[model samples]
Target chain A: MFVRGLKSSIIALESNLKNRTLFFLLNFVLLVTVFIEILTYKHSIALEPHRYQNFTDDILIVQMHYDSETPYTFSSIFDRKLASIENVLYTQYAINQYIYNKETYQLSVKIKGTSGNFIENYDIVDFYYKTNGLPNVKKNELIYGRVWTNEEYQKGESVGLIYEATAKTIFGKSDATGERLNFGSHSIKIIGILKNTDDIKNYYRTFNNYNLEFVVYTPITYLKSDSLIDYSIMRSYNNDILKEIITNNISEKMYFYEREDVISKTLDIKKEQLSNFYYVIVVTLIICVVGLFQLIKNFINQMTFECSIRRTFGATKFEIFSMLVFQNSFVFLLALMLAIVVSIMIIYAYFYFSYRYVYPYLSYIDINIILIIGIAQLILTIAFTTLLSQKIINTNIIDGVKGNS
Target chain B: MYELINVSKSYGKNQIFTNLNFTIESKKFTGIFGESGSGKTTLVSILGMLDQKYTGNYIFNGINITQLGDRELSTLRKEKIGFLFQESYLINEITVFDNLLLNVLDKENKQLIKRIRELMDKFAISDFLYRRVSTLSGGEKQRVALVRALLMNPELIIADEPTGNLDKTNSEIILSYLKSLCLENKTVIVVSHDEKVLKYCDIQYNLIKNGKLERCL
Candidate 1:
């Protein structure tokens, strides 16, 4: 009798594939939401072990525009002294003229010129650099494309330039080397294209503000500027020296930030964005639960007569209960498998489009989701259906079988 | 054999049967006759162990059924009692053979299949044994129900209007098959509104809406 009940149950489920599909899809949506959220948490865990360290020897120092009332040349007065400070870094930006082909957009080129220490201090080596050498910058040299090339770094010349991700929108599939770019009416030949680094997100997509964008890399000494006074940092061997230097040189307008602080700030911003998304995910899950409850209720109601018939044939309350649960579980398992396949396809597509996040080829589904969904559905179906069918077991059998309910 | 001792049943404030006493002797085909709302169906239910919320003592063979626990009562119903209804309540989606074979869960009981085949052939319903219940005719479905009931080799059969949906000829045929159960000394009780069925019954009882039972001619 139990076997027959199962066979009939399977027939019923197969006959109503549409309804089962809807149920399966709702569970899938919840599974996907939980999967993504758990992945987010996992991302934090992977990142925590490799936390950024702020060594007192390094700092971010910004230099004010050179012409404001300070008449002394910062180069002659500070060059020798600052160079001895250990790990001094400077950057400069130039407005470049270019056209974006994909979105038919245009922007000025934003450039960063830094010494060899730039890549070391940022810890971009393990993530982006494939070689041990720093980006060797020399006068009038450029390294093109998205990343630093060994040939450009090895020559100790500033001629090769790396193209920012946004450069692709302006010159889709075009060999961009040797092209003369006009920046503030000053033309410089594009040398090399930089490959995408993991640090910058979506380095290939085009942006509107070309000047404000990270579009290219060039040799630090090649930049020509009179107002581009030196933005250099001095590292101290101890906190006392660091504090003493900052205390004496402190200005009310200057802003100082540490590397650890910068990383925390970025993470905090990401957390805020995810919190808003959490609300939507939670609401969707609640709706799905309600829908699942209603569906199970309606289905059990329709089977009241069958339950009565089974009871007449000597089915114990537990046996009857088992049959219902077995039916529901079989259907749930089928739908669960289908939904997993669907969700994996979607996750794969997402990773294909956004590979900058180091997304693994596949992620393990959190056990909490499986437990909550699998156990909850099983318990709810059994409880609701059994409660509904209890009347069949206890009711006057004559009316139950006579289609009176 | 089944005995009802002063059994009384009610629905809310409405009393359907009160202090009713009756007995269905072993191997006797007893028919219960009444008008609509005459409480015949309710009486059949109590006999089938389907109705428990009643004030009375029901003794099957020698055990008082009302005192049994849900599990014990269910065991009694499954292993001893059988039922036939006016409309065949077979799960329409399954094949008729599967519907009949489903009742015997003890797979090694080869007698189940042999009994089912004999019953189906006896009722001339063997042709549609593999067909879906929904596709069977009214007469054929009733025969299938008979096969299902007889498969368990139950001690007693409680049928409520077993042939009520059949024409006069089919009704006689069904009643005759039911009468054979009595010949085998299997206690049988049926609730019916059809007057024609009274002839086949060895004993008949009439239930009054005023809550009384009387032996009928």
Candidate 2:
């Protein structure tokens, strides 16, 4: 019986061009709404500053203007006695650099440079592992070789440490200590090989300019200092007061990227995007309902005679309902499929054309929300048509047939 | 095979049947005659189980129809009866073949298909089988309706003004088919204003006279 209705539904769809177009429009609105919602949610989470791997919440990343050749050296101003409040643990900056391995797989790994071991002292490895949703990851341990002394970093030595696997891929050995690991045209002496974590596949992830997959502390002189941002971890008895003091004392000329501030701003952005999508949904629903009512009016005018004929010929009322709903359902599903394809294409075209860090955030989009929306739309349509079709079903058969005469 | 006791039906201020009692016997051609406003259509609808909203008890094949719900009444209409109406009453958009198959589309099989072919052949409408109903002549459409009415091998057939749109020749052809069903032990009730067609009925009723069988020549 449903099959019969389905076949008739196809014919019904083909008969009315207005119905088909309206149906498509209604479904397109729903599909675009859901896709936009998912995109906004994923992009908001991705835009969160934690992805930069800033493990030390006690830190403030501040960048000031600099000339290409003259990077500002972190020195106290004796003229203002600024040395009284100087608590910079280390002067360092990190930048993202792409590494193409032997297989030509490009991975964006952070190149961190520091004047001291501020990274190891604050349990950077443990913090990154914990933030990455793994609580039991091993602590940062140098499997081989010694750490570069402060003198080496101050003298601008071109030296670094790498994860064991990264070392093997670079120099064909896990223990590549004392060997030169060539990155682009520059060679860094492998002073240490950090014990690789299980999640080396996450080399693309960064924690506040620190590579979560491989911890490579090179000399500051090796990095393009002008393209880097300076970050310093403040130490004080009360961390909140120190953060407040630093925020107040920092020059307005510096760009501040405080984690708390960034997180809050990103959340506001997420909320704004969600509210925009909701408005789109409401506007589309209103248009769709108006269109549906018009469609129902047309159905009553056109389908009354046909339904009467079927009823007179032995089709039960329920069978008539099935036929009607299936007819509309056919058009609804077709529109839904078209909307899905179009929404995906739109997202792809937008993302692929942008020069920013592109991620296929759609791949990890939350699907339950989409399903809920689809089901809601289906129920709304079915219920609306059901109420109207009931009138035709319960119509006086004699009057219906005779009225057409 | 059908009985209606004290059935009174009204459409708001307009009353159609007022405390009318009627009965139809099995395997007979019953003709119901009445004036235009005397409610011949309303009477047939009640007999056809299409209109059950009446103040009466209806027993068909020994089941109380007045007690049945819409679904049950619909099942009775589908299984035990068939209907023919004036104005061709065929779905004009679909093909003749599709129109015939609409009611039995779910149970369509070799046997049903062969029966449909045989009926079309018998009605001399086999040539127009695949043509759309909208394109068929009035006589051709009525013949198709006749074939559809008997396709289910129903126990009862109710037709209201079945020949109102046909000419003399076409009218005779349709009336002859209704008469022939009686020989096969099938009951047929036809409501028509034509005295010429009333001559073919084995039993006759006058709805204008409080739903009594008139026994008219």
lDDT string for model 2 (A1-405, tens) is: 667545655544544445456656756675675655555455445433323222122211111111123322222110110111112211112100111113222112122332211221111111112111111224446788865665664565677666677666444468989986442234468787778776533432322233333345444334433222123322232445434443454322122322224434555786777667667666765666666566655665567776777787677888778877776666666666676667667666665565133343334435456556556666766776798888888898877777732
| Stretches > 4 Å off in candidate 2 | A1-138, A141-281, A293-301, A350-372, B209-217
- Given the true complex, what DockQ would model 1 score? 0.32
lDDT of 1 at A380: 65
Tens-digit lDDT track of model 1 for A183-206:
322344555555545433332222
Docking class of 2: acceptable
Provide the TM-score for each candidate, comma-separated. Answer: 0.64, 0.65
